[model samples]
Target: MAGPLASLKVLDFSTLLPGPYATMLLADMGAEVLRVEAPDRMDLTRVMPPHDGGVSTAHGYLNRGKSAISLNLKDEGSADRIKALVAEFDVVVEQFRPGVMDRLGIGYEALKAVNPGLIYCSITGYGQTGPYKNRAGHDINYLSLAGVSSHCGRADSGPPPMGIQIADVAGGSHHAVMGILAAVIHRQQSGEGQYVDVSMTDAAFALNAMSGAACLAGGQEQKPESSLLNGGSFYDYYQTSDGRWLSVGSLEPQFSSRLCDTLGLEKMKSFALSQNPEHQVALKKALKDAIATRTLAEWQAVFSETDACVEPVLTIAEAAEHPQLKARDMVILVDRGDGSQQRQIGFPIKFEKTSCRAEWIGKNLGADNKKYF
Candidate 1:
């Protein structure tokens, strides 16, 4: 059967991770996405390292299943062409600063004039209107401004560096998809397309739902190691004898009791999440000492049959080969049309009937120029 968004059309003018990722998700769900590039400039990801068949691996993954066309928005003729195309497409996604598109004559109002039902989405660092609207930023800057990084570190050594681009993927890409879908639904009802102004910083700030609420609502600011979920208690990672790590999440009373018994620390059961600083340090040290007595694999075997919620941390390679993720089809093989295949992370959302697949990798620049022209 056709995917849920098989009938929708997306005109993607954004490049790089955030907007491209959002459009890729739509394309995976069966939307007809036409990625528009500049004839003079190209997405930097096209040259990003880790190549397959001489093409950037990251670009191949992000732009898969989407068509490409190049147009010079600087030219009047090209602007006219885009204006004409805007009337034919269902949505337009751009990642320029506030007034850049307006100067190019293809802003939301200009497109709305041609197709009033056009869903125009603008993804930016800050927003279209604000004191820092034109400010430059990346994942780290946004995460810091949003107060997310302050609560994500070890109490003694300060915050650890983030491995992933949380602000780019979670703040921008995911939220862009959400806003676009919401606008799509709203358009279906009102028959009037609207503008979606997505600010990465705003989205990052909104992600502070739990800790921020504690401070704002209950007057409880989250300290470095005082928050229960942030490492104030026994719910933390411990290094084992073999240098590997084990995560422990024995938060509840019963689970804590079982964990204490399993670790031969019956005294710790009563102090699972004690708020007293001295008691907390003593309990943590005791648990650490006990855990350090065994290798990570040995501890894994000991708690494998229990409900202690303790598990060994695996490297990326081990994670990819994990039986549980393999059983769930979380990793899949994508054929490259040659004798070889590329392994890619699979789409998470599953449907009972509709099919979701990455039909192809990123196309050559302007591969579909003739069709558009």
Candidate 2:
């Protein structure tokens, strides 16, 4: 079936997580994404992790649907070749340090000169211009600078790294995709392409909307896990005797009451209704103690009988084979011609009519050079 972005064509100049993820989003929607890569750098991810056929583990996971093409942007012929493809593509995505593209003569300005209707997006640690624009940093660095890392760990713990590339994925990849889509919409109406500069640090800060609002209102930044929503006694993850976890989200008074009633711990009823700061920890501990008394399945069986919002904390593996996932058709698998089929993080968005669905697996480096060239 033709995806919604079937007519969209993209030239991907990104290598790592952020840029490739953005292109993957579009490609899943049926856009023809042609990833451009230097044979040497070759999306270093391709070299990391679970691999079989001498291909980078990272390559097979993120670039399944993408086609590979090798080229040297430093070569004048490569730059010229890219320009020729620009006129035919609807979008261009690149993740390079500021001025790197301009230095190579393939920046947004140069590309727009070829196709004015092109939707060009640039992803960087900082935007194309700023006091920190030229500074070099990675996801954690950007998160630290943006104050996200400050609030990520436990309040009592020293600085700890936040797992999962939040800055690269949320700040860089996701933001770049949104910007590119918006530009595409604008281009359709105005027939004029524009440059999209996605700044990771700035984007990281944007994620501080809640913390920012709280801080603006004179709230002291607290540790992330301490947040009422994080895993307070009422809405926290409790470890059962079986070493499994039961995620309790009985935050609301009614849900808390229901959970208390289900736990048969009516003595802790008032704790659920307290605004007193001291009660937060006690209430959480009480729930934890109660939950720890049973196995994960026992708790699941208990919570499943109650209206208290609760569920088993399943791993990605468990979630893939979960009844809920099957009911919603969440896990999607595809054969990438590597003997074993490729598995991926599937799409969650669904449109009522044009329901958004993941249409392809990721691609390898420059996975589509011939198709584009």
Model 2, C-alpha of 42: deviation from truth (Å) = 2.3
For candidate 2, write residues 1-373 as lDDT tens digits.
5677888999888877889887887777778878788977656787777774565656655665666687889986877888998889999898888888888989988988999898889898999887998888898899889987776655677457865899999999899989988888888888888989899998999998887778878766756665676443366678998999988777788888888888887888788777665787788788778888899988877777788888898877888888877787676766656545556666666645554444344555555666767
RMSD (Cα, Å) of model 2: 2.2
Per TM-score, the best of the predicted structures is: 1
Q: Can you tell me which runs of candidate 2 are displaced by over 4 Å? A: 52-57, 217-220, 223-227, 231-233, 338-340, 355-368
| CA error at residue 357 for candidate 1, angstroms | 1.7
Give one digit per residue, the lDDT tens place, for model 1 in 162-232.
88888888999999999999999999999989999999999999999999999899998786777778888
lDDT of 2: 0.79
Identify the runs in model 1 with alpha carbons over 4 angstroms from their true place.
337-339
Error at 128, model 2, angstroms: 1.4
